[model samples]
Target: MLPPLSEKELDRLEDLLITYGNDYSVLNLAELNGFFTALASSPTTVMPEQWLPAVAGGKVPKFKKPAHEEAYTALMLRYASQVAEELGDDVDHFEPLFEESEGEEGSVIIMEEWCFGYMRGTQVAGWAELPPEQDQLLKAISLHGLEDNFELLDQMSEADIQACVPQVTEAARRLYRYHRLQD
Candidate 1:
């Protein structure tokens, strides 16, 4: 069991969020091969709880259509499930790139999700937040550095879904950054 992010590192993580605009950039790094331990143990170093209350909690109040936050949360959950299953119990042993998703809810009042998954994640709700009936949202999803032939959310067994979870998440996290932060 690694320790949580220290105050100093948390500050840097916060700064990183401000610089990039989205938190996923810092959260998805286990694939990088370095700093995995540091991130897993102390994800708050990069993902800062400060942002959670504003974004994840009902504080900021989305109050808009097309809830991007919820989409992001679901994507994170998919990643967590994959990481938990693939990495198994060893997940927490290292600095988990993504924490397990926990306590998620959607409603008309507050869009912000309580979000405890993905080590910790953010949530939101809004109109058209559904996964889409015709593969629209899934189409938007693309895991990084995946097999060219690999199709996301397509025909496969539970085992396939499980294996693709982390890859799917990496894609979402990357897309989230590119959509919001990356110019």
Candidate 2:
């Protein structure tokens, strides 16, 4: 198994992505984590060639040096592998990397970016029409991730959104298990 990235390495990767510029549609660390998680949980394997370009917003970045390119690719692949292993080995304990902010009510989990990334992963995987039961699992992620749901989400109180956090997490876990069972 590939070694997991160190905290310092993760920070470095995040910095590298930012340096690449938002104009390129680069994903931040939290979003990347969510993206990887979704890819890892996908019923079908998504090759790097298929998803790497998606990471760079449809165009692969031109690295300044071969070493930089190698390091970046290695880090991303290892991180993705780690996510797959984590979910495959223990779906019940899988935890998403969500950002948190201090709201008036105290700390609030920011699921938007992560969920958006996950939804992107599902798209990259070209998910087929799922059964209603499984579709609900995907909807949990979409409710927070998709801009189309913004109006519906707006109607929810902070507490309501907070309450949905566990549901989202559980939904992801269940989705993973459901796909694994199909294998």
Q: Over the full model, what C-alpha lDDT does candidate 2 score relative to the true structure? A: 0.86
Off by over 4 Å in 2: none
TM-score of each: 0.24, 0.94
Per-residue lDDT, model 2, residue 55, is 86
Q: What's each prediction's clash count?
A: 9, 0
Model 2 lDDT per residue over 1-183, tens place: 888889998987887777664554546888888898889878899999998888888867888888778877888898889888889888899989889999998999989888988998898898888999999999999999888999999999999999988988998898888887663
- Write candidate 1's Cα lDDT for 1-183 as tens digits: 333344564444434334334443333223211122212222133342343343323232242435445544433333333433433344323232332333333212110111112212212111123333212322322222224424643455445544544443443343233333341
In order, candidate lDDTs are 0.32, 0.86
Residue pairs clashing in model 2 are none
Residue 102 displacement (Å), model 1: 16
Give RMSD (Å) of candidate 1 vs. truth.
Answer: 15.9
Candidate 1: lDDT over CA atoms? 0.32
Which candidate should be chosen as best, given lDDT against the real structure?
A: 2
